[model samples]
Target: MSKALLVHPDDSVATLVEPVAAGESVTFAAQVVTALTDVPSGHKVAIRVISAGDPVVKFGFPIGTARTDIAVGAHVHTHNLATALDGTLDYRFTPSVPFVREAVAETATFQGYVRSDGRVGTRNEIWVLPTVGCVARTATRIAALADAAHGGAVDGVHAFTHPFGCSQLGDDLAGTRSILAALACHPNAGGVVIVGLGCESNQIAALLAEIPEARRSAIRTLSTQLAGDEIDEGVALVAELVALAKAERTTVGVDKLVLGVKCGGSDGLSGLTANPLVGRMSEAVVDAGGSVLLTEIPEMFGAERLLMDRAADEVVFDRTVKMVNDFKRYFLDHGEPVSENPSPGNLAGGITTLEEKSLGAVQKAGRAIVSDVIPYGGQVSRAGLTLLEAPGNDAVSCTALAAAGATAILFTTGRGTPLGFPVPTIKIASNSGLAARKPGWIDLDAGAVLEDGFDAVADDLLARLCDIASGAPTAAERNGEREIAIWKRGVTL
Candidate 1:
């Protein structure tokens, strides 16, 4: 394997393929250079002398400015570099990439649960939803009871408990209601039992109004205050839904698949391995006439233009611009730097600035055109690629992806996490080391891309994803890490 990788010809820095000590010779961009300082694997090292305030190029774009004159072969990170990203700025829709839609093979298909409304589901399970946080435990208890009694009759019984639906105002309250409503309507839930506290601001009636009447038959409602035994009532309701579902799976086209692309605990090799590997999967899914959703708006601070340039049309380009700038405004309004991302975990994994991180994060989207832009708590409409408005937080963005109608999420991580949203989340490891160390956490070894090539591994990944879609459980699901988190951006009442 190469000692270091020069991502782009214009890059002045190269990522270390392995740790190197001072005075060690390493080849970068086909040129040998002596390491001036110790550099860790996945961290950047200056391949050329960079003057103070001069831009440090990586991935063929400027990640940030050098804090001081960086000598050739010196380590390049936060200590010698800082983000150039700040408050919102004006953007022009200069289309650089042309939209080229890949042809979908008519023969591609997967086994899925076809809903009455024509939507396809990757699972046939009973879901217990709470209209208010007050009934969260009640919902969980009911799901546990139902799972114990009727789990065999269905895929499984799961409860998505969250701490919202009350004491929230404006968008915050509406976001909670919308996300709950979306879950209630999710096709994966062959039957749904909505548990309510009877007096929360997010009333069952209001939430039901958001769902179509066509889906009402599959959804059962219960208010603890209105029932003598809410758990028994909820279980009975779920049983009836289970009977109605029959736990049957039918063949569906790849067009029915909706995938959410995400990454967490990313390390240096994330961009080179796991992310790009997932990017191939994303492109293949899109080429198969399926839809893909990508979130983490803040992480796109520097790489936003790459997505904008791939917008399907002028309208989509405009929406993409607004989504990026508005997220920046949100940070500025909160007195936080726009680059206040790349958590301690990210830095530890060899990431430096938000720009470097953003560039890597956006790779999960592949080269698909932006078909639509979804707001927080909104559902995906267009089928190609949708850019969702969401923060960089893992839980929040994963929840948003689930609420946006993704039946399964492809999550790449260098530092593993056992977090799962309502849908199945497949964790792909960026490095073989992490995969070997945490077999229970990683579902796929994307690090193999470095050795076996992306196409070879992506074919395996696509197969794995199909198996998950066809009822195979993921690591997260097997570990019982299901959860939901709504983004709260407003004050409480």
Candidate 2:
């Protein structure tokens, strides 16, 4: 293994992929130097002496500034590196040089189920939606019954239960209504059975009204109280929905697809490798007249301006701005700084600030024009590159995207994660080490782009996407790690 990796020639620090003991001499590229301090794996070490307040550069950008005088070869981390508001940060939205499109198509297409609304779905399943926490158990009972009865003919029955559907007012109530309606109408969902208590604040009529008229007929609503609290009745209702969903069949076309892009457990290699490869695949999907949804509002903090510049129209840009501002307010109202992101794992992976992470995160959006920005728990209507207002947490983001009609999700990770959504989640490893170590979770190794070539790795990713969409199981699906979480906006009584 190499002693250290210099991400850029101008970078003053080098990343240590493996633990390097102090006083050990190692070679980096063309130079050999002794380690002044021990450097842990995935952390950085200074290659030259840095005075107090000097900026520590990584990925050829200022990640943070040195808090104390540091000698050459010293370990650079949170102890000595302090993230400040003032720094020499640079962002490239429109590249100074145009990106050359690499032409390589395999005439690849996936067999997906087509919905009446002209949307394509990778999976055909009946959704059991609970409009209020009062009926969550009823929803689960329905899913269990449907799974047992139609386990052979249908894909699967999923229970999308949330803690808050009632006791919410104004924007919160509207948001919940919008999300549940969107999920009921999702292409992946052939039929929906909504469970609710008769007197809940989130009324079944209100939720049904939000859905398109054609889709409302496919949804069956049940009230446990009205049905004599007979769990058997709820089960019977859902079993019929499962049979109705099984009637839908798979078709082929790009126009029927809605893809979501997400990243978690990110590292320095994320932007350099996996994220960009996903971006390339997103571009291909967009070019084919498909939609790509990018969410995790906090991850787009510093990068909002770039998306604003790419907005298709003034309305889109304005919405994008408001979404970002509202998210900042949400965090600040709770006495937390909007910049207090970059979890501990991120710092260990060499990301120092929210801005640094955002710069890397936005690469997954590709260069597509921003068509629209939807509020948290809102449905995605416009095509092209759309932004969904959701938390940066993996499960919440994936759940919101799935509700917004994403039939599949492309998730990029560096530290490695094993979670999947109700829809197929294609996991791409940012580096080779994690891919090799966690073979069961990582579906594609994007690390090859860092060592070999981007085009070849990109081709591999596209091929994997087609396979996953065509019914080949991803590691997440095979392991049955179908996790879901919705972003709740209001107080529950």
Model 1: lDDT to the true structure: 0.89
* RMSD (CA, angstroms), candidate 2: 3.3
Worst 10 residues of 2 by lDDT: 87-96
What's the TM-score of each model vs. the native?
Answer: 0.97, 0.89
Candidate 1 lDDT trough over 10 residues, lowest sum: 97-106
State the lDDT at 340 in candidate 2.
Answer: 83
Q: Cα lDDT for residue 137, model 2?
A: 76
lDDT of all predictions, in order shown? 0.89, 0.79
Task: Give the TM-score (vs. native) of candidate 1.
Answer: 0.97
Give candidate 2's TM-score.
0.89
Q: After aligning candidate 2 to the native by TM-score, how far in Å is the CA of 37 from where it should be?
A: 2.0
Give candidate 1 regions above 4 Å deviation. 99-107
What lDDT tens digits, residue by residue, belong to model 1 across residues 116-187?
878899988999999888999999998998899989989899999988888988888988999889888887
Against the hidden true structure, what lDDT does model 2 obtain? Answer: 0.79
Q: After superposition, how far is residue 45 of candidate 2 from its true place, in Å?
A: 3.0
